[model samples]
Target: MKIGYIRVSTAEQNTIRQEILLRDLGVDEIYIDKASGKSTDRPELKRMMEYVRYGDTVIVESISRFARNTKDLLELVDKLRQKEVEFVSKKEAIDTTTPTGVFMLTIFGAVAQLEREYILQRQNEGIAIAKSQGRYKGRKPIEHPDLKSTVVQWRAGEITATAAMKRLDMKPSTFYRKVKKF
Candidate 1:
């Protein structure tokens, strides 16, 4: 069986290109994740791993799309290998069933990890510069329309705390914290 995996960094990013390529390759099933590859915590990725059987082939658009760092990439590949599954990366022309492909994967995985580290370093530097220049205001607070009324009602005993929390769509801890601020 051939299983395809497609991923994009955010929900807004399209998976069409990867999907089309995987479909063109005649994959039987496709799993997709619309989240960061920085971690291997994606739901679809986990599902695909568990779903694969022996003699199955896992097809990916690229190494970076599969994993953000060498450690994660290698670990995932090791898992697949243990299950007797093969890995194929379309962009890198890597097929882990061959010896040369395995060697190439290691080199590419290292390069991917290095690239991720550089990206993080540059992002941190940019943030530090922005902070020093007083341009970074940080994330804006969420404004809930009924929060004030709900908190007031909860405080005044007109509504139960649980009722107010339900109305505000907040957990007990969040409700109490906001109550303190108000």
Candidate 2:
């Protein structure tokens, strides 16, 4: 079976292009993850890993969509190898079944990692420049009408932190961070 994996960094990003390409290539199954490729912790990725069998081929739109770093890329490919599964990256024309393909995979993985690093560096530089000009104020704080009351209840032990967070529709990190500011 030819299994396809498609990833986009955020939920808002579309996977249409990757899906179309994979479908055109006659992929038997596809797993799509609308999460950053910085880590292999995505739910869909985990499901796909468990679903694949020996002799199956895993295909991706590109190396970056599969992994953001060379280490992660190698580790993922190694895991696939252990299962006797092959890997193919469409854009890079890489096939793990060949020796030259393995060599090229390493080089391309390194280049992808370098590209991501450069992108981050450039983003940080842009943010710094904007900050110096007083144009980068960061994200606006989230406000809820019942936030104060919720915090008071939480502090007085009238409600659990989890309950307060749910009432405020806030995540644990956000709730704790906001509470710290009180």
Candidate 3:
């Protein structure tokens, strides 16, 4: 079986391009999510992982779509390898079916990880300087009228967290942060 996974950070984004590419590669199933790939709890991705079986091939448009960062990517790949599954990243020209793919993947993973770390380090430094200068006021709190209702529904088990998230149009992190301090 050939499976595909695609991710984007926002609801306004579309997965059609990646889908078309995966379809051309003969992917039989495609799992998609519109969450910031920075986290591991994406529903569709988790479902897809649960469904994969030995000998199945997982295809992704690129390394970032497959995982949020190198750590997650390597962890997922290791899991798939343990299950005797293969992973192919079309854009990166990586295919786990070959020895050279393994070597390239290691190099690529290291570089990608370094890049991410450097970006995060710079961001943290900037934020710290801004905060020290009293210029780092965060985003204004959401002012939606139904936020309370949504939180009630979510806490009451009347609606799934995902449903509440969509209704609020907030990322999981933002939603939870608001809920906790609201």
**Structural similarity to truth (TM-score) of each candidate:** 0.86, 0.97, 0.70
Which candidate number maximizes TM-score? 2
The residue-level lDDT of candidate 1 at 105 comes to 96
Say which candidate scores most in lDDT: 2
lDDT of 1 by residue, 1-182 (tens): 99999999999999999999999999999999999999999999999999999999999999999999988999999999999999999999999999999999999999988998999999999999999999997888656899888878777899999888888888888788778888
* Model 2 Cα shift for residue 66 (angstroms): 0.4
Query: 12-115 in candidate 3: lDDT tens per residue?
Result: 99888998999999999999999987777899988988899999999999887777577788888888898889999888899988999977877787776777
**RMSD of each candidate relative to the true structure:** 2.5, 1.0, 5.8
Segments in model 1 whose C-alpha atoms lie over 4 Å from true places: 153-166, 169-180
Cα error of candidate 3 at position 63, Å: 0.9
Q: Whose TM-score is higher: candidate 2's or candidate 3's?
A: 2
Error at 34, model 2, angstroms: 0.5
Off by over 4 Å in 2: none
The full ranking of all candidates by lDDT, starting with the best, is 2, 1, 3
lDDT of each: 0.94, 0.96, 0.87
The predicted structure with the larger TM-score, 1 or 3, is 1
lDDT of 2 by residue, 1-182 (tens): 99999999999999999999999999999999999999999999999999999999999999999999999999999999999999999999999999999999999999999999999999999999999999999999999989998999989999999899889999999999998988
Find the 10 residues in a row with the least total lDDT in model 1.
137-146
